[model samples]
Target: MYVIHLRYTGALAEIDDALEAHRLYLGRQFDAGAFIIAGPKVPRDGGIILAASMDRDRLDAIIAEDPFSQQRLAHYDIIEFKATRLAPDLNLPQSPWL
Candidate 1:
């Protein structure tokens, strides 16, 4: 799977405006099964992580439609990951590697 890290770097005002659209987009992804988990940073400064499709091209296309990207409210860095291990108690229907 891949993790997209989105960090806000511009004015909070712009981020606020984009937040709603961003949330909606994320909801769509969830409904479409393209998004597994997503949320903001705990400290409110680290950014957000979106764990979903591993295809960078597909992920990039989705991010291109994000409000943050469209409005230039934030910058994003994507990282590809391979699931080498998972907690023994962890339970998920799909492979953690996606």
Candidate 2:
């Protein structure tokens, strides 16, 4: 029900390291059923989008633990909003309504 948009602004050399951490973080979130979908932007854009829990506190905790934040590898600008609509391709097996 919430999406996190993250932007990376560090040296390009750090991308690989940053991605490793991101992968672990995403794995944890997925296993915990906190994150719905997450991935990097196309064209190698320095950004990623993560769809996550509806709870702001939970989302904030997850972001705080991000490797990008811990290693100072990237800066993040997060926006929290209700998903008023979703694409037909959107999948939510965990969602009660779904």
By lDDT, the best candidate is 1
Clash pairs, candidate 2, are: none
Worst window of 10 by summed lDDT in candidate 1: 89-98
> How does candidate 2 fare on TM-score?
0.76
Query: lDDT tens string, model 1, 1-98?
Result: 66778778878777777788889988987776677778888766436655654567777887888888887877888888776787999853463225
TM-score of each: 0.81, 0.76
lDDT of each candidate versus the true structure: 0.73, 0.70
**Cα RMSD, each candidate:** 2.6, 3.0
lDDT of 1: 0.73
Q: After superposition, how far is residue 86 of candidate 1 from its true place, in Å?
A: 1.7
Look at candidate 1 and give me any clashing residue pairs.
none
Encode model 2's per-residue lDDT on 22-90: one tens digit a residue: 789889878877777778777554666555545667667777898877877767776766666778998
Best by the TM-score measure:
1
Off by over 4 Å in 1: 93-98
